[model samples]
Target: MNKKAIWAIIGLMSAAVIGVVVLQMDLIRTAVKVNEERFEKNVFAALNTVVRRLEAEENREVFQHSINGFVTAYYEEHDNTGEGKPEFTLDYSGEDGRPMLSPKLSHSSLLDELMAEFANPCTCSQCMARKDNTYRSLMVYFQQNTREFPLEQRIKLQHINGVLKQELGNRGIDTDFNYGVFSREKKSFIIVDGHYVVEDAQPKEILPGYRNIYNSRYKVDLFPEDMPSPGLLMIHFPARTSFVWRSLWLNFLGSIFFTTIILFSFAYTIHVIFRQKKLSEMKTDFIN
Candidate 1:
């Protein structure tokens, strides 16, 4: 083959190799992007689940406290010892004169009635006004009695940590994470990583070691129903980027290995072709 044809073949092969490498790199980039997106989605979902569970737990505690208080008050008002049957009762007579049945007005019955009323409040003007007042009073009582507890007392660090770990693990994310509970009322992080932070530092200053905690966009309100300023539950994974890339490392290495092999093979083939052409020229000259 002439030098021009040999050079042309070399250029074509080089271009083909370059194109293959570009396509491979693009494929690796696309895979990395998809992995990162999936990781982010799972993290967000886990955070949401943790927030909901925390809210539910707090609500349950508050309602349980209120129910206990209501029961205590009912017994005290009825002048009955809690050990015996309730003294409050009402008599009813049948028109056929069979026998009169006595209905007991226990605290349980009263609670049932309240629940029924709450589920279906009367819409009449007078009834609505009364119901509104009752609702306000009940809410006030709950706030004063249950919701007024300090943030640390309201939620335990172990519980928060455990819930986060469980939820994240459930979604196949087992990375090391840092978390902080930012109190909107206090305008600072009240708790971080199973410890109460009493330094009163701003959330941005709380986790100096893990700067990503404050910068993280993965946060949810601690209790959305809490009026005005529900606290924030923030989470950050230090190894998130590495974790996302972990699954693609094999593919990346494989691409590099194969591309290197192809380039090596092309260079060897070109060298052989040139050497064979030179040997043929020498043979022809010797024969002539």
Candidate 2:
């Protein structure tokens, strides 16, 4: 090929290599962005799961308390009356202040009466009103008795750690994490990892390495229905960025390897073209 043709081939090869490099960079960038978003999504989901589990635990306790109260009231009425048949009144006082039943029965009879009264009911106004009154009173009782303990007493650091680790691991994220429960009422962190931050104390100053715990990207409300103000659960992963990038290392290395090979081939091809051109000129001179 002539000099012009040889230079044209070199320019085209250079442009191809540059384009390949740009494309590879863009692909890596896009991959990193996608991985970051996936990581965030998983973390948020895990936080929500933790919050829900905590709420369920509290609800279970409240329900158990309500059942015990109901059973105790039944026995008390029976003992006071000193009769085989006792009148039981379920007076769950709330805003409505409506009386559900004043039945003359025994414990077993009461259960049967309750079933007969509430279950297999027709669409009558009286039955519907009774159902609505019963539901509202129970809800009021639950709301009134829920979360009687303080935030610190209700939540344990070990439980939080265990649940968070399990939930995050379930979502394929296992990393060293720092978590804190910030009490909105106290306006400070009640607990952070292994230590408890006192009211009005600076968490950053108290826990040097756990500075990010308060400003964590992953956060959810703890006991949202807690009176006055609800607490916040915040989690920060120190090694999250490294962990996310680790997954893309192989792709990055492979791209680099292939790109290197392409450049090497291009260089060798140019070198061979120049060498042939030099040899052709020498042969022409010798022939002249």
Candidate 3:
């Protein structure tokens, strides 16, 4: 190929790469920001309902049942089984004058109580560990098929970043927490993605008070009688999307694609520049 043509190709390739990178970065950032806001609002809304119900009932037993039910329902509905069954079955007296099961919380009294208790803080360590009500609320919210705020309606990127930074700082931790939010584009979806490890300076100790509350709240023996201390709280912060491939592999592939495009473009540009200089010298020789 002629020197000019080679140079042109190199220039075009470089421009193309720069364009793709700039565009992708912006799109992903926007997507991540939009998703984060959607998560905050939607998750909070679900949690608010639970809080209101909890406070209204003030019955520790019933409140525990509702909260646990919501959590169970969330996991069950999102289960790998692919069964589209309702998680919480409402038990009540039917027209047949017998008890029946349905996927409805017909007991408004129970729901009302749950909502109320949810409104008030449980005054426990884990709950008090974080200051924000929204995050705390998310720790225990449950509802299904509600209209979520549009991506635009979500919080701004700066705001989200600020809140997270502040929350982490308050906990005496330093780490970049990358969050993304997306919806299944279908009715009632559950997604799990994005994970990072948090290192604890102190030995993993589930404070007695916190463990007791979690035990009562979830009805699960999270702390076994056998082990003294679990030694770590694995914070599995979820993403709005499911990963089709492992994250490490995905990242590796992306890096390779980006690097190849840049390196090839640079090498091609250098080759074209030298070729052009050579051609110009030959033209000079011919003219002399």
Candidate 4:
């Protein structure tokens, strides 16, 4: 082939290969993204399943009604201040008892112990102290509109934590996660702080020297659509930037290998074309 034809062929081949590589890369990225999203949803689904069971648990209502009865009675009795909190709620201290304050009961009070077993539990980054009443009680305000049941039952903590631990163990999913239940009607106030990280089955750590992308936040509504949602459930899963990087490295190496072959072939073709042109020139000079 002549030089011009050789160049044209190289151009066309490079363009085709580039197009295919770009398309393939795009497809690969899209596939990874979809899988990541699905994986997150599955995690949420598993957690949600646990929560639903807890919510529907027969004893759950038993506990909620108990809290309701306790708080309602306290509110009715303590409403000497015409504008105290209409709803019965337990907050960190008398501080949370603002204008709408209800009866402030200590965690260890006889009534609190007899009824809700309120105790100020120790607080931590990973978990809330249910005993200390740090967990707010918003059940009284949006009682009708909310789909939430009381999380004041201390036993429910183990149940909730157990679900997460069970799922991590069963699925063999290596992920560090923290989950929280938030009330939308209550201005996104947390109904149950489910931020416990299962220590034994911690998620695979991000590979060193790789960016940590495990800070992704995902929220899935607890209540079903067309139904009133008292709150939402949110989970944070550490991103697998290391795993993603491994895949990217392979892709980069593959692209380099492929492009190297095409470039070598194109160079050889050009060399041949130039040699042929030189041979033709020699023949013409001999005839002249």
Candidate 5:
């Protein structure tokens, strides 16, 4: 083997290595991309589930408050004696043949009608979902106090974050997550944080409320513009970017070992060929 042939082999091997490296890099990128897309899809679905549940819960709370108010009002008018619980009878002789509590005020009738309207009936797929008003209206009759409760309730930041953590678990997303609520009205500040966080999710300039947790590209809007304190819900996934590398670490190591062996054996073969050619040339010169 001459020097020229040796140099040519080295060039060919280098080109082959570079080509394989380029291809491998692209393949890794593609795999990561596909994984990310699937992750986002799952996150979106999970978010939809949570939003639906929130809506249903809000309706239920409203209905309960309404019935409580109605019952308290009715008792104030009817209760002449300071009795613990009042006993009342309803007549079922109305046009609808339904039980009626004193047709004079017809307040009970209105309550019954409201209960009937909100009652869950359908067994279909859509009805079974949280979007459907599948819960029967809860009725409580005869309460002492008639005071109205506050219109707005503070959102539980911790509970919501915990639910999101559970949501990811149920969907088999193993990566860490963090949530932050941002408000533009209060001088563009973060008022609250969902406590599900990891160390990597923190931004360099620490905000007022949020802690560094998981970092992800998924951001959801919580309560939107309907609430008195409207804000944006940010969900982060810190480990998502390195998932492919972690999962395929063994395969990458094996590839490196295999490549090293192949290159070393090739180099040894070239060395042996050069030595034999040198010995043959010296023998020919001595015989001549």
Candidate 6:
């Protein structure tokens, strides 16, 4: 009913507005962070699914090369770095003493060739043009790890040799594959004996994005538990903007929600002040 009361209400409303604005920012940050985290976690999970599948499968050479081609192209298109990349590796020594298969290989003469092959043969007919040339003397090494509970060493070694031998044999050329299991005690790598031949019937592609249509089956359930395991490709998750955005978004959303409440409170205060003023005027008329 008094001027002081009206001014007090106005001040409170003003403070409410300011509070709402400040809190809104925090809400928005919170919401965005939470959403982004969920997104990133989902993406990481999808990637992990691929990793697990590759690891679980006995043979991974073809799949590794195919995925490498796809991922390399995908990252290049987005201008993203292959930081904390998964351990899917391609090491190949060409005739020129250069590692031709891995994109990370220094002195990559086959970059153009690889890109062309992957884009053309791997891509659809209407996709893009690609060159075709099977480079000779290219040695590729493919490795993946399998970890099952109730640890068995022999079985692990058998898996390592079997996958490698089968893959190499399917490619139609025989090569000696050196398998050394890493050790902390011996400080030496042991040799795995086997001559592998890639057959003509079940041909394996050494190039990226090439497919292998093999139907031969090998018995893998009889290996001993003391066999040495092969090295695995590492998958790392680096600090990314996705992580930061996820954190910020959660805070932002929280701020926004609080801000909205503050605004509503301010509006209600303003309405009450006007109603009180109208009542005061009516009381004055009655007195008059």
**Against the true structure, whose lDDT is highest?**
2
The CA lDDT of each predicted structure is 0.75, 0.77, 0.41, 0.52, 0.54, 0.43
Q: Give the alpha carbon lDDT tens digit for every residue of 30-93 in model 3.
A: 6656655654454444333333332233334434565566557755765757755443443324
lDDT of 5 by residue, 1-288 (tens): 577986787778778867776776676677667766777888877766665554445545555566456567667755655543333344445563444444343444554554553465866654354212223112122111111222113245565666667777788787765556544233232433543223233445444334342233565555442434244555666676676356666766766776677668767876787788789889889999
lDDT of 6 by residue, 1-288 (tens): 688978887887798688768666666657766765665454444334433443445333433454556667755654665444322223434443333344453223334444454455445432332122222222122222222322223224555556554543443223232332322222222222322222233333322211110111111211111244332211222333444464466556666676677778778878888898899899999999
By lDDT, the better pick of 1 and 4 is: 1
> lDDT order of candidates, best first?
2, 1, 5, 4, 6, 3
Each prediction's total of clashing residue pairs, residues at least 3 apart in sequence or on different chains, is 0, 0, 24, 12, 7, 48
Give the higher-TM-score candidate: 1 or 6: 1
**Per-residue lDDT for 23 in model 6?**
62
Error of 3 at 251 (Å): 6.9
lDDT of 2 at 150: 70
CA RMSD for every model? 8.0, 5.0, 20.8, 15.6, 8.4, 21.5
Candidate 1: which pairs clash?
A: none
Give the C-alpha miss distance for residue 15 in model 6, angstroms: 2.0
Could you tell me which 10 consecutive residues in candidate 1 have the lowest summed lDDT?
Answer: 92-101
Model 2, span 196-280: residue lDDT tens: 7675444334355556887677888887655544789999888988988989999999999999999999999999999999999
Writing each residue's lDDT as its tens digit, candidate 1 over 39-120 gives: 8899889888888787668765675667667557766765565454453322224343221113356544544554565577
Q: Estimate the TM-score of every prediction.
A: 0.76, 0.76, 0.30, 0.47, 0.60, 0.29
- The list of candidate 2 runs beyond 4 A from truth reads 70-140, 194-207, 226-229
Kindly give the stretch of ten consecutive residues in candidate 2 with the minimal lDDT sum: 200-209
